[model samples]
Target chain A: MKPGTGPLLRVAGVVPGLWLAGFFLLPLAFVWILSFGEKQGLVAVDIVWTADNYLRALDPLYLGILAKSLWIAALTTVICLATGLPVALGIVFAPPRWRPLLLLLVILPFWTNLLIRTYALIAVLRTRGHVNATLGWASELFGLPFEPLSLLYTNTAVVAGLVYVHLPFMVLPLYATLHRLDRSLVEAAADLGAGHLRVCITIILPLAVPGIVSGSLLVFVPALGSYLTPDLLGGPDSQMIANVIERQFKSANDWPFGSALSFLLMYVTFGALALRSLSVRRPAAR
Target chain B: MTEAVRVGGICKRFGAVTALAEVSLRIEAGEFFALLGPSGCGKSTLLRIMAGLEHPDQGSVFIDGIDVGRTPANRRPVNMVFQSYALFPHMSVRSNVAYGLRVTGTGRAEAHERAEAALGLVRLTGYGERMPHQLSGGESQRVALARALVKRPRVLLLDEPLSALDARLRDEMRLELVTLQKTVGITFIIVTHDQEEALSMADRVAVMETGRIRQVAPPAELYEAPADRFVATFIGQVNLFPATIGADGTAQAHPFPGVTARARGIGAGRQVWIAVRPEKITMAPRGGVPAGRLSGVVEEVVYRGDLSVYLVRCMAGPDGLVRVSRANAARTADRLPGPGTEVVLDWAEDCAVVLAS
Candidate 1:
């Protein structure tokens, strides 16, 4: 960390740098090279440069899936923001002794495997699952007729599963920002004749925009490219773009098209992040 | 003068710590008052209570003769400038100043005009476009003041307003605050532990200690005739000598057996302290005429630009050390006493205030 330690610093970076070059960057370079190639047969792809696969991705059928994926991801991000905000605030304002426990609960889900977590969602949302079974028991107790609701294997289920997994991503950053926020500013707002709602809308939200930006990106990107949740919990009509990419590599046997699709999703994510940096860096007064 | 704010029998406790204990004060309108004390002495807590940010456990706060004990801070007719100048960091200085007006539903044009006027009052007219983070510490402080003053409340509370500023800036702001108070003619209640800040600006000061108001008096009275040993020492540097009162309305001073000083309103034969400010004592050479019977060698001399403090160690004993401060007159620039110089210390009968030991 001291000055004139440049050689040591460069040496420290060599291990991770080589790791990335070998495992991550090289594989990504291979994918980029493969994306320009033409599919020869069931197994191999010719090294001929072609834009045909990217052109194929522009088809209306795949476009519709991509659009649906964006909508679902956007909706999931919005819901996460709404729900995670209150939870984060609650944790921040809780007694100091209780805060660690509350934060642990938020992070506890990450310890378990994501695939197993998605399966756990299946038990709660499937037909004759816990929610409907509880409702049906209540109906029987009340002597009212009822039918099991089709809750799982739908777009609604996919959104719910996404929100379930991504809520912590939203809450953690929000919690960090809210925790560092000066409580005196809120008190100052109240002292200056601001009511509770006005203080929140005028003072709290604007200050929290940075956290919301990062949290939304954290939830939206993963939700857009989500594979396990939609694959397991979504119905036949709920095929997201990730599902299409998976089909291209597996049954479709078109590695070039899959690589192109993956890169396309990456481009959208990067574009959103770039746009955010531009707006966040703007120095103009609002 | 009309009463601006009054808190009656206020009592507050935070867990085991008693922040305020049956404290009460009546502040007059258009008067600048101060609550002065050390940190954690409940001055800021009492200010917050008056601002309606805090509620007392067993008391009522009256504003303009109406008991608004239960009113929230937002509903109260008072504003506070915080110690840290808690301006909204996300807002521009203009919006920060106009926040109270805008939030309370003032028209946009009117709010903007009044906010600009407030900014002008603080002498920060063209700095409104800068964000809170963009401004310097003193600028942020003025923005906070402008923010609160724009609301035009009947009472303005400042909690340690100048503590964050450097020495020269604090002196400048003390004068500005006094001038601003007279311009607006609203009651200004400032809380500070700096004796100079409280004494210089406040029309009257309530000196607090350990959650209790020890004395409430004008600046001159608090400085010249302190109510107790604590105020005497806290207001400025003072030399306290333990003594017993004589039957002739004079205190029998210690160590120097021949010295006795007259003090008013104390029973005879009681232990007391003769409290004299360092500036009050005059220094003379050893064996000089009109000097006290006692004499000591100058132990140390601290040279301040305007004045010099001399610590004289009397020949009587260790308990006989007396401190004297003299103004550095131009005539004696070459002859100022240095260390190890033999000298005599003397004070007038009126210089000492007698307090119970």
Candidate 2:
């Protein structure tokens, strides 16, 4: 026992610890317990233990939706990294005076409500919206025949919305890591006869792995569980597992089945994350 | 013998500050040259220009008598060991050393073999598998050196290569660097601010000040006959006196009793500065002042291990203290003058250097 740390540390840990125990852990424990129960009636569950909910949750229909959700999440993560890495690099290498302003712009999307931002994206992506209208105007001006392009209510729109909403999550961590990168290391690489692309491939990307992993995890986890974007922008075929979970809890009135589905989704997310961490760690440990 | 590098009237300006102003020098092949100066004196800028990392606004650079003024750093036949060493933290020492070769499209096996050989040259043979973060500072520094040397460039530029090490490690590395330079026998240009490091390692040193080269000469010539006052003081401790030359070519200063030194190439009655090294001046117990000798009271005595320095306030010449250092040959403290003890200071007339103001 260190002298000063005894009481103060315990006091500091009390509020957050109690909050996690009350709000987070308690509900998670309740959900786990409910997953084993049987649905008795609408919005009601019997306390009798059963494996029926797990078996139902594993049906091929639900499994297909889970696979679709995984694919969409993976695609969103790839798009975010490809786009966010360049913007992060630009911000990190900008002049010191412009760095704070650029970083503020990167995070400025967070200041607005995410739902409102998604609706705004709808205004741009809809069939009769800004993008199609602009293309119509350009076609008319060029005297070429054209039809309105249907972009909304598609899986592409859902992925686009997810990328737009989660991009900052990718950029911020990458920026934080790139900001501390030693400039002399880049200069040394050039001095040792490495071209610009070679330097990025050999030095910059390898050093930024931690940032990449963290950013990917942040995007992938939230994209997997995203409900609003798929519901608002996706068509019937583009509906993800989150939409099914929402239906189970809301209209279907299957609380035990919903709990089982949610827990299953949580397990899949954890497994994906564990696999990613293992892959990222093995190369670094070498 | 063709010179390895020839820089001609190079000038660079960054915004409002002129970093290098028409700096020109030539480095011979297989020579170990040093650019010695204080911070912001353009020594590092000159080294970067030679490495093709910096562009000169006004002049040209020639490597191996070929004009390479417009070449990019990656295409130049030169490399630099940065002051920070800048070892890639994520890569093993082998990969870090082999990166340059790999970038040039060498086979992986050959690159690794060459990297291992270069590491052996730095006496870090078994350190190839260790990551940069796992090594000590000295080990990382050696890895950086090996990485740069593996390219076998025509010239090597080191920017304050030893400023990061502790005193003991720095001394040991200094000796190793000298031996390495001799074995490799390439044109090595090292930038340093430490006068002792420059003096001990460089075959020729160019002293710079305020973006201009003050003097460039061999270490012995630079120490014994500095071209200007900055070189005289920047290289070592010295006492400078404002003196006037007589019609008979004799120089007289206020601090000395009579004629102190001979002035050459100066008109009669013109004022000049005379510099005398502290070690050249001899201190003796007070007596009647002799001709051309100055007498004063010892103001302070700083006793280093192998030498003792006496600061004497001159009563006969200038209104300033003249410093004199004596080798500590015996354990007789009583024989050396203490504070308030009267002392006489004298130096050979030929030992004083006449300089422009």
Candidate 3:
């Protein structure tokens, strides 16, 4: 509305507009176009517009893998929420001088490469890892028979690795929400004859809905598309959707099918986002 | 009267800062008591200790003649209306008010009915279904009061309940709060820094400073007499000058060689404060025997609607200024004394109190 500011605002928006168009929109369009094409020959895709690739993605074997990936991602999201909520609360209620240190510890994992962290998980969960060795020592101390339990190359390892890598995503959002909360509301509840558990259930949890939703989505979306963690820590039976997509592009030489699977994952992400928006609207409508 | 809340020697420390230092207080049953002080004077800390929200490092809190020092806030028979009101934004007004009853396992129908009755008490009968965001500041304050009162607490604690309202609404709520307290017939303990609010609503006010109680008295007594200089200046406007007492019950100041005022204390050569309210001093045209009067030039005249204040520059007074206020009781031609007018300020023999310096 200011003089000559319309053109000036348009000029300022050009930088991010160009970057998003070039990096995100172009790649997404390419994959979308590839999804409707067919594999004509080895190492090439034909531009014959058809739904064959989409149909092949909906087959029983691929559907089974998608369902398994959803179960794993859902389990990972639940675990992250349960663990991250308490951690965020602890950081929020800690002494003012110690808050920065606790937040730094939560975020320090980001400085390390994900591949290295996943590899570290591999080192920790393998047959002769720290946990099994500790259990062996405890059994010896108790004078009982000792057997090293198999902790590596299972679906459990994949879930464990996913929780570890994605925990900070959950904690950061929950912390941001709970920190901005008016603590006096909790005090008022306690003053009105509500004890600790009642306050947590009636006041804290209901107020933390937005944080819980966003944290779950952040963990679930990335966890569904996880590749390196499952590759390093999961067994053959624990193949997720991302691993299947990789095999379609690499081992099977089928770019069209891989693009179709990628678009399917994008649809799931959109669905989750729609749920979040619906929840936000529900409170506003009230 | 029977005691409702008695906190004895309550002590609390936040890290290195001593927030409360052996504070003690007593509130009679069904009496409206106010802990009045400036911010960070340990009034709110003492209130929290009595509410069981903060544990005292050392002390005992007895409510209704029973020791409740170890009880938690939720277990105590007291509830607080927070300064921010602390209304649950996610709940409707009815749900918020009914929360206390429902939490203690009361039936939903009965809780709803009692909540409605409490809302009616605050004259918010139809606003139960509305969320907290839909209410105004004054409305939210009433809802908070209703929510706390619905539980029928033995004592209600209000932490600056009207501090968030506009000036007009604050005045309105002050009278309403007193009426509601009397109607309920429960002990009420209020914490506030506003002297006018405390003096107007509370039956007894405890003035605090620097983690200690300065004095506790009724409004009239606190205004007419103060225990020390802190209480003297904190409550209302006063003219203060240091003076030494003589054996003849007359106080003498050093600036003017022969000026004297009567003081009832029995000590001689003791340094004390000569405290007189601004309204107690009378200013007239400078032409009298200068025995007990100090002559000065009028520095400024502040014209309020109901009263006028005269600031006189007197060499014989501490800080070189003496303040006198005259009420505008009737229309008069000479009420406006412009600056630079010469005036004589004098008070009656017993108008001032000699307090320990």
Candidate 4:
């Protein structure tokens, strides 16, 4: 190392390392340790051995919640990809002067609090809200048979909210990756006698796989852990594992089971991520 | 003889800037041509117009006598090796070369076979399994060539294909490219700003300036008889002296204490510029050719490996100076002109070009 890279470097790096250890790592470690213990009253049991919590959490009720959570997460990822690819491509194709402005708009929703954004969905989905009011006006003007629509407290509403909130996370990285792609690659494909559609499928799409994978991870993982959107916009049938975990921690006061559920969720998340990296790793290696 | 490509009065404008204006050129079959210019001279833009990647606002692009004004780039029978090579980073070299064939609905085995053969054409056999990033810069450039060649286009456009390589690599690749063109027997249009690369490799060079081609000639002809002041300066280094034409078809350029050249043909009272190559100007001891003599002091001497350059302060104008380069063979330690040493500069009248503008 260089001579002056001593005191200033340690102050800049070591301080952040200490803070992460004290704050993020410590809480996660406590939760992990708590997951291995049994619940007596409001605290864990004295014994440090247990597989029962994990096996019980895999019971029908919690498993059903897991299925619902995975399904919602998968759907949100699909919707984000379907919508975000075009937005990302548009940003990449925009003029250099306009690109930053367009990106700022893509990320604008994140500036508002997540809770406020989710609640804004509720306000819009209400019976007399903007959507229903527009439909009612269209019906009155066209003389079609129509009434006020019901969209609130539905699975569709929950997915719409999830997509709205997580879209920037998917789009920003996709835009960055696509922007780095050489325009000459597309021209080369075309010069090789590939039509526009062929160029997109054979060259552009395959080259952008990294971006798609990253965007999917950004959208899917967070949607799996989401509770507020579903709680506010979804009916009882659509509640995910997070809602169950929230209930165990808050309503039931079952800290041990809640801790176990949290660890199980983390295991599933890491397992899915590990599988994704493994699958994509081989093609990249070649 | 077939005209492989024809560009007719093409003009392109990007907002307010004119990139190409009324540009026209015909590339014959099996010929190698080069567009030589500096950056922002619109050589690339003209090449793009011919390749159908860009459309000219005022004219048409024809390939093999086919009007391809509205035809898309894929429909044109041409391929381009981009300046950066533009190899697909995610795909293996084989897959990248095979991409053109696969997109055209060629069978899988045949595409692979042709791709291999194309790779072999560039002397990159057995490099199919490696990704673009794994290969060296020259290897990637070869793969890009293979990818374009696999499609078997009638015309090949090379956009400064050797510019990315180091000096030694560039020299090696220049010969390789010339040989490759001969082996392929296809029409090749290359764009370059390197004067040596253009002169050494191209059969014919089109010198461009300000969105226009100033002259198109063989490299030797262009170097010997440049059309204008810009061409004279752009093609090679030259010393220019402002002069005036006389009524009796005589021109005068005085770069000495009291001497001038009685140049011919140009009318009187017109301003002209006389250009002479540095090698054309010869230096000698204080008084050799009294008729063409110019007394000057040696300002600086730059002794290059093969030649020595002398910057002389002449007496025609107070601050006028001219440069002359001599071969390193005749070495005289005693008469070596240093700073403040008096000398005479002289050149044959036939060696200079007088231009009236």
Candidate 5:
């Protein structure tokens, strides 16, 4: 309402903010508009609105696929937490000169293409891969029967691949948080007569919760939407929502269904993130 | 009441740099001892060793007559108030103070009782639920002290606990800490680089230098009868002059041509240093007693309200500078000693200490 007030606020903060609104909010609004429209043979009338697409998307078969995707993503996240915490701790406690080297080692795999890394796991877990060959050699040396194990295309392999590809994403943040934790808190716990494990549980773990939660979030949502690892290392039963969306858009030639599936995936990811945001209580910044 | 702590022949080294060298001391049950030193002087290192945070490369440590050399920090009978307080940011003030009790298997009700008592001791009774970040620096420091004292350590160690506070708060906390020690009757070992802090709060001060104890004595004894040149200069502002010992133990100190004094165990022509406190020296008018008198030029005069300090430079032999502070009641606007004014300095022979250089 005032002459110079709006421009002053613009110079202070409002300008860069409106620029983001123009880019991100405008595109999201376009997608929301497209999501509610009806398409018939890819030439539907824009005015004809229907809730049928949403209802059909809730069909048991599609919901079952969504559930499977969520379950696998949750499992992948839990596995990352179990393995990433110690690795993060090790980096945090490392000597000052060695910390940078250890962090670099954890992130070395990320420098290459993610697809390439997942495929590398494919080479190692095949029926006649390095693991089987090593087992065969060991059995022959011990004068026992040798057999090539079947681990190439399975859910276990897919989960393993997901963890490997997303591990640095999980570890880097946890390491940053753990490294910044006040070491005196741990010493104080020990002085209070807490044993080693008690110190870790009460002091180290709680302080590191933010990092753990953030690492889980960074890994979980992407793992849920992942199609590459599963498609390469999984069977038909292991196909995730992203694989289904890919199939609908490229192979099925059903534009309306594909658009509906895309919107549904976005909605589910948004809802999960919203729930996560509500659950993890943030510490007040200094 | 306990015997408190005994540290015997503790030595520590970080690679080639020896941080603490064979330091030994005993703390009484209820005395407040201070390790006073400049930065890099290993006072904090010794305190950390006593707290079990650092392992002595050689020697043993005991608390309440129990050998705790191989014991972990959690098993020791000592607690420390870190310089930064190190209070858990996620926990409230009450929880932070109760943390040690809770982890040691105390029940919630009992832990809360002790925590409340400790908080009350530090005068923070109603602030239990406030987070550490919400408290002021002084309040947080008090909370840290309460946290350590709540555990009832046989000996409480504080590493520059008041170094983080502003000057006014530091003075207030000094008084509070001394009173708290008396009230609790627990042994307190505080490490500080502040000479005034050491003099004002400690029962006995151990002055450290270059990873070793220079002298350990009462604050008055340490300042009045320093054992060496380092202790004399470090404790307070002093004027030192190079002198030589003569036969019959009478040493002719320079700048005072005929001034001689007794020096023990010194051969003739051996170099020695004479120490004189600024307040101990006096400037007199013309026709003053001529014996034990030194001649110097008044370099500068600075008025500090309560007293005025005159920096005088001796022109002959070993050019030493002496500071003389005159009381404000003796202020004079007439013929004040300006720069380059010839003046005579006189002091009793007992006021000056002669030491081997």
Candidate 6:
């Protein structure tokens, strides 16, 4: 006879479930309660319930940071998808022996620390860096005078950094999905008079939506809350919402306001993911 | 009638393995043909070559007298039903059936109308809105058939179409497929490993082994006059006895001391094998051995509901069992002889076929 799932599952789930409730849910509940309180002196909280923190977070100055963050994250996601989709497809369709090596190359960057990798990008992008030095040498060899271009410390550099870091997040899911696609379905479509473009549009693209949704969520959520890349690479005008939140907690000593801002980001991210999952589920149900 | 598909001197190799070796065959415009072989025998490869899914390394394929060796699969006049059915999981039944028409730029209304007609022909008219995953295995196969037939292709290729279904559904679909083919009146080519499917459904079958065609014949001729030892044994169960031909045009083999059967196409003193089907041999009571009969002892009896199979140990043969099958026509207590009983077996002289390979 089989063991009953009731008591056995409850016994097995006790440790991890209690661990999550204690360390994760308890802190989140405290943060929610703290968002409504007032901040007193440094590291002190006063129990005066008010809506002032949320009101201040809705100001045009803070809202603009949020919008800018969304724009940058959206752009980064688009660029990653445009580049990652082809790379993922290539890996899935590559010769059997070369596939593992190519996948390893995609993941090799993760072995290094992300902060260290971003700092290394500065050497390639700075004026008189590797790129400018190469361009200057090529111009001089051609007997043409050239000036070193300022490639770092700009919005472009920030976007490039975000895209570089998030590209693998987009590629891995797409590879998993495309690899699971049946090759016979493509052959059947071709046998039914669909050319290569039609096969991609009608079959491959629609079937790959789950992967695209997952990859977009993976890239977008982290990008929206990112602070390091913008601070290290962007100009003062390119500040995002996360930079503001960081300043509120560390420099301004405003714990309640920072908590309120964090909740807002969480709510918006949750709403977007919920909407995406709903859209994905409807077609599958039909 | 003009040939619908003609493959000439085709050869295909996959790295180190040769899939097809200078293979060639012609299919008529409306005939049901089958390529029958075991796994790795290159029947599927030849079917793919005809569908333009795989290209031959040498020679050419002509559909309706137009050389299609350079044509891509989408542009070819042939379509295939894959082994897995390959239905689009996301699409509705209507959309799946209409996919071919829509891809070729047919108008939306026309494509839908033709798709509905195709569905009705397959008796799944009310299942248009259902997803592919909602259908059973047999329904999925019919939808695949409807999808291919909507294109009205010059030739239809089925790669093990019914291999995935249960036994009852496979038998039903076999008849349905034959009726569908006749109603549509287009050429159909199927690849299968089941000898029974090939013999029962195809108007003609090409038996293949090691990338070469052993024989191509109708069902009756293929069973009655196999070309060599492979076709003789591959088509059905046969009892083979190693023997030699005498100068008097007679075969001398074990269990039959005197020269009993005559064979053609062999010189005297040449080695050969005589083949006879199990059902062709008649079993009688003990001590009933006639002048040309062989005697044996029944070692095992397998009683199927419809027939009884007896494994007999031949007293004079080279230490092998000769099987005999008898139909259970009447329900009687002692209709079949029990095991360990002595029996005499004899077959008509013309029933034995001599193979010299």
Instruction: Give the docking tier of candidate 3.
Output: high
lDDT of 6 at A184: 93
Q: Measured by TM-score, how close is model 2 to the native structure? A: 0.93
Query: TM-score (0 to 1) of chain B, per candidate?
Result: 0.96, 0.96, 0.96, 0.92, 0.94, 0.96
Please, what are the lDDT tens digits per residue for candidate 3 over residues A1-286? 9899999999999999999999999999999999998898897788788999889989999999999999999999999999999999999989989999999999999999999998888888888998888899999999999988888999999999999999999999999999989999989999998998899899999999999999999999999999988998999999899999999889998999999999998898788889989998999887
Stretches of candidate 6 off by over 4 Å are: A1-23, A130-149, B258-260, B316-319
lDDT of each: 0.90, 0.90, 0.91, 0.86, 0.85, 0.90
* Model 4 lDDT tens row, B35-69: 99989889999999888898888988889999999
Cα lDDT for residue A230, candidate 5: 95
Which DockQ-derived CAPRI band holds candidate 2?
Answer: medium
Ten residues in sequence with the least summed lDDT for candidate 1 chain A: A277-286
> Which residue runs of candidate 2 sit more than 4 Å off their true CA positions?
A1-9, A137-144, A276-285, B247-249, B267-271, B288-292, B316-319, B331-334
TM-score-better candidate, 1 vs 3: 3
TM-score of chain B of 4: 0.92
Give the DockQ (2 decimals) of all models.
0.78, 0.73, 0.87, 0.75, 0.65, 0.80
DockQ, candidate 6, comes to 0.80
Please say which candidate is ahead in TM-score: 2 or 4.
2
Identify the runs in model 4 with alpha carbons over 4 angstroms from their true place: A1-5, A12-18, A41-49, A126-150, A276-284, B255-265, B286-299, B316-319, B329-346
True contacts kept of each: 0.89, 0.87, 0.89, 0.91, 0.71, 0.91
Residue pair clashes in candidate 6:
none
Residue lDDT tens for model 4, A128-230: 8889988889999999988787899888999999999999989987987888889999898888888977887878788788889888998999899999999
Model 5 off-target regions past 4 Å?
A: A1-49, A132-149, A276-282, B1-3, B258-260, B288-292, B316-318, B330-342
Clashes of each: 0, 3, 0, 3, 0, 0
Write the residue-wise lDDT of candidate 1 on A157-274 in tens digits. 9999999999999999999999999999989999999998888898888888888888998999999999989999999999899999999999999999999888888888888789
Model 5 chain A worst lDDT window (10 residues): A40-49
